[model samples]
Target chain A: MLSDIAFLFYFFSLFISFIGSCIMFSKIEIAFKWIGILLIVTFLNELNTRFLVKSLSIQSNGVYHFFVPIEFSIYTIIFATFINLKRWNKILILLVFLLVIIEILNTLFLQPIYVTNTNTMIIESVFLVLLSLILYIRIKESTYYKNLLLEGVFWFNSSILFYYAFNILVWGFHNWDFINPPLIMYDINAFLCGLMYLTFLFSIYLNFIQVRKLKN
Target chain B: MTNRQIESIDVIVFIVAGILVILLMFGFILYFLISYKSKKRDYNLLEIQKKELDDQKKLLENTLSELRATQSQLIHSEKMASLGQLTAGIAHEIQNPLNFVNNFSDVSKELLTEMREDIKKNNIEDALELASDVVNNLDKIYFHGKKAESIVKGMLQHSRAAKGLLEKADINLLCDESIRLAYHGMKSKFMDFNVEITTIFAQNIPKIYIIPQDIGRVILNILSNAFYATIQKSKKISSDYKPNVTIKTLYDSSGVNVYIRDNGCGIPQEIKDKIFQPFFTTKISGQGTGLGLSICYDIINSHGGRISFESKEREFTEFNIFLPNKSNLVVKIPNNVV
Candidate 1:
């Protein structure tokens, strides 16, 4: 029942995020449109993974292994656009390819098909946290006239940093008997996903409002 | 690894991550608060400085307007002083016409008295002759009376303050009248002084737009100075030496140019540049206010014209004034296209 409630919470947040993206679609910039599309893909991924696990009796690990590389690659593009560092963008593309290769290697040799892809998730989370921190520092160094709270990027990147760091820290103790409680971990993951979606909804709304103000 | 060791490690790592998150949030909050306060303080400082600058600008504008008012008043008084000096010459000019009118009136009165006596004595032919004489005398009186009236009218016109508006003006008429007035003025002041004057007026010159009173003042001032210089030079030179002043006007596609040249003690090189400076004079004390040339320069400049002089020391000096024609006047266009 607890796991069902968490799943419902995440689905509700994702639905709200989808609605925000639709409202912001025509008014927002190209980069923002990409982010909105990324959110929609993540929502679909979650639904597909659940359908595969419950209805088809298939392991979710296979879905996650396929999704991680794609999800992180989208994140790489978003961060590359956000940070606006040319040299780092090329380096990030190379790193993303390497991460993809490593994820494939872990799935093939290190982790069984039925087990959780903890190694790939941990690596992805750590890289996302680092990129978010770097983006935060870049934004802080830039000249800004709007309030930090009102800035869409600030909230969006902060959500990424917080969610990924929390994910990695929690999953890092997967080897410990007391730490890897399956139900509690699932609840926590679902809560973190809902929080990220909520922040993304705020970011989309703020971006829409800002663009509307500029048009006026 | 043992279950107890793994659990301890997990708890420690979680505590450290949570601590890091707390510290980062606190740091961001502190930085934002400091930046907001600093920006607010800068905005307040800029507002105060802008207000102070505006106040200073207002004060400067007030002082500038006051100074302009004083300058105009001084220029008016200078014109009045010039009129005062011209009064003697004007009075002398009208004296001859007055004499003609009085002499003709006396002869006509005598003729009328004789005609009345002849009519009473029944001398009809003699009365008819006396009536013809009286008619001739009356015509002379009328002619001289009109001349005196015109002189008075010209003086009154010059004395009236300028309205400072551009109007259709005849350059030749203006130049001739000013020359006559200025010549008589100087001659009346210096009874023994004499200078031969010549005028070369451009024929069929179109009426141009000008502030008549101001331009009249400029012409009068230049003539007065030219006459003065020649008179002074004549006083020092031999009796055979003839002091001459020439006035010329040219109208063409380029513009209207007026040259007032005088054979006199020319302006020295060192003092030529200073000639248009306010209160600059080479005339003897009490003879000049030293504002005439400077005012002339300003009047010409204000009319979008130029005033310059060419002089040969101890020989001659000439002043040239060039006023651009209608084609050269600045035209203002509206912001919106038609």
Candidate 2:
């Protein structure tokens, strides 16, 4: 029953993100297009993980593993677009290319189709944590002296940094075979994702207000 | 270390570092919020300071207007002080014209009676001659009446508080008028006063632009002081000691120059510097408003001119004035103000 509520909350957050993305599409345009695409892919992945695991008798674990590398790569591209630091940004792109090659090799041999790709997920979570740190630094060092609470970039960077940091911890616990991870782990994962998506919606709203102020 | 132990350490390090980074980001955001609130407070304070400055500016404007009011009051007081001298001078000066009028009226009355008698006796030639004599007396009477009217008019102009404009004026005429007014005015007060006033006027001096009334006031003020000093000295001196005031006017390439010298009690050394200060008077209170010399100094400075004096105590005092020849008026002088 708890799992069911987690699932419902996850879909509710996705619905909110979808509405926010549609609003942003009509307004600020291309800045959020990639993020919207990422959310759509995540929504499809969640749907498949819920239904396909039982009905089609297909391994949803393999699908989750397969999609994780692609998601991380897409995140890299989005960060590259946002970050003005050309040197670090190019290195992040190179890292994405290397990560994709490694992921392909892991899926074919080390982690077969039925197995959970905990190793790759852990690696992706680590990279997300570091990248989120870099993004936070960029927001902090910015000369924007206006209200930080109202700043969309500040909120977005904070939400991502918080989620991925916890994500690294959860995936790391899965890596250690001896440790019996708590049942609440799944709930935490669902709640964190929901909260992250809700923050994204908030960021979009802030951007809209700022853009309207500028135009008027 | 074993491979398993190394893997565990790696997981531990990643989890710890991730938590630390999140904590640091939260710290940065809190700092930003606090800083922004403080800046808003400072901006509000700056707005209040601007409002206070505007209020102070209004207060200063009010003070400046009050200062102007005080200056006009001072000018009025100086005019009142000179009024007494002006009335006394008018009395002494009008006596000559009045005597002429009286004598001419008597002569005309006798001539009219003789002409009537001649007409009654049928002597037409004598009656015609008597009629011509009566007409001559009437003309003299008219002339004397006009002269008396002019004396009253000149005195009225001097006594009235007039903020008159600058114009082309003969400096010598101003000095002569001042000497007449001051000497007569002094004589009326002294009763038995007699003084020698010698004028050495230069020929064909071109009229310079000046505020005729203000310059008149300056000359009258100086002449009155000179006469007062002389009268005071005369009372203490022997019978042979004759008080003399010599007025000389000359013009050269530089400008017009006026010299008013008095062989009176010269200004004492101790009081010379204080003479031109407002309300600095040696006379008992109510006898004078000591704004006279200060007003004179301001008037000359405004005209782009200068006035200076030289004196030896109990010997002589000479005041020298220089008016510019060029049209370099600091204050604009208009025309026909007299």
Candidate 3:
């Protein structure tokens, strides 16, 4: 029962978080819409990975290989659009497109579709961490917010930094061999995924507060 | 242990080490959040304090304006009080010439009646003598009437300045009138006190443009002070200490200077610095308002002039007034005034 609970924990959290984001959809900033869409997609992906694939007795790692890059692409779009008013947005989007093509080739030629895309996932994590740190540096020197905690920009940037920084640990120590048990990896991934969704819910609620204040 | 289980331990150990490193990095983010929060709170507190100080300053400015209004009322009353002091002297000065005119008119009426009776009796020489006597009596009446008219006109000129109008006035003559009014006012109040007064006015001293009444008030205030000082000295001396007040007007290239000196109880060393300060007086309550010299100082300052004094305690006190008559006048002598 404990294992079952632990297994379904992150999926349930993502489902709830996606519903919350949709309910307050109109109140969120323009920069946060992509984040809301990312939540629903992630929730559906989690449902397929945790329930559908397991019920069919097939490999779930292949689904992650697809979902991970989609998530990284959305994050990159949001960060590039938000920072510097999208100063190098065209170049950044092109860079991600090139990375996606490289990732496809990597999956086909080096790792294969049935296994994890470790190289591309590690590269995505590096890019997200770098963007988040750049955002943090800008926030440190800014005076635009009455309270940073109530700002969607602050929450989105900081959460990216937090999750991706820790995520580097998972990828750095990934066990590719079938001889190793995947129990610890599953536990760490579920915990981090739950934490990330929780932060998303917080950002949505903070955006609601900020919208209400502006109306007043 | 089996080989598979040993391999899992190594994987767990490596992942946990990576997690430990990220945790160390997370500590810095936590510190940043805490320090930023603290700085924001301190800045908010200072903003509130600064707002409070601004409100306090505005309140203080309002209070200062209220005080200034009350001081203005006091100054007006001081001017009226000086006018009140001149009232008793005005009455005494007007009374003398009126008595002479009335007596002379009565005598002239009697003389006319006698001449009419002599004409009825057909006594021409005697009637002519009575007519001549009547003519002489009328002449006396006319002279006394003219004298009364001149006194009334002089008093009118002295008190005519209600709008602070600048006009050329004989400074020496104003000094004489102010002295007479101040002396008579003091005498009416203190009948037994007497002081020998003398005047040494300079010749060819042209009439300077001034608001005569304001300068008159300044001279009156000083002369009043001198009289009061002399009166106080008299109580102690009583036997042979002769009191004397002297007025001298002199003009050089600098300005017109009037020196008013009196042998009296002079200013004390302790209160000398406070002599011209508002509400500073040595006299007992109800005897003095203490605004006399302060008003005088302000009046002189407004005229682009200055007032100073010299004193020896219980010996003598002299006030020197230097009024700008040439280049220092802030006011122009109006085309009609000069």
Worst 10 residues of 3 chain A by lDDT: A174-183
User: Which residue pairs collide in model 2, if any?
Assistant: B166-B211
* Candidate 2 local lDDT, B196-247, one digit each (tens): 8899999868998887777887888888888887887888888888998888
Evaluation by TM-score, superior candidate among 2 and 3: 3
Tens-place lDDT digits, model 1, residues B252-273: 9867899999999899999999
DockQ comparison, 1 vs 3, better candidate: 3
Clashing pairs in 1: none
* Candidate 2 Cα errors over 4 Å, as ranges: A1-216, B1-11, B33-50, B155-168, B188-196, B203-209, B231-244, B263-290, B312-316, B325-338
Q: What residue runs in model 1 are displaced by over 4 Å at the alpha carbon?
A: A1-216, B161-174, B187-215, B230-243, B248-257, B270-307, B321-338
lDDT of 2: 0.76
Clashing pairs in 3: none
Please identify which of the two predictions, 1 or 2, would achieve the higher lDDT against the true structure.
1
TM-score of each: 0.56, 0.61, 0.70
Candidate 2 matches the true fold with a TM-score of 0.61
Native contacts conserved, per model: 0.03, 0.10, 0.17
Candidate 1 vs candidate 3: the lDDT winner is 1
Rank order by TM-score, top first? Answer: 3, 2, 1
Tell me the TM-score of candidate 2's A chain. 0.89
How many residue pairs of model 3 clash at the backbone? 0
Question: Whole-model lDDT for model 1 versus the true structure?
Answer: 0.81
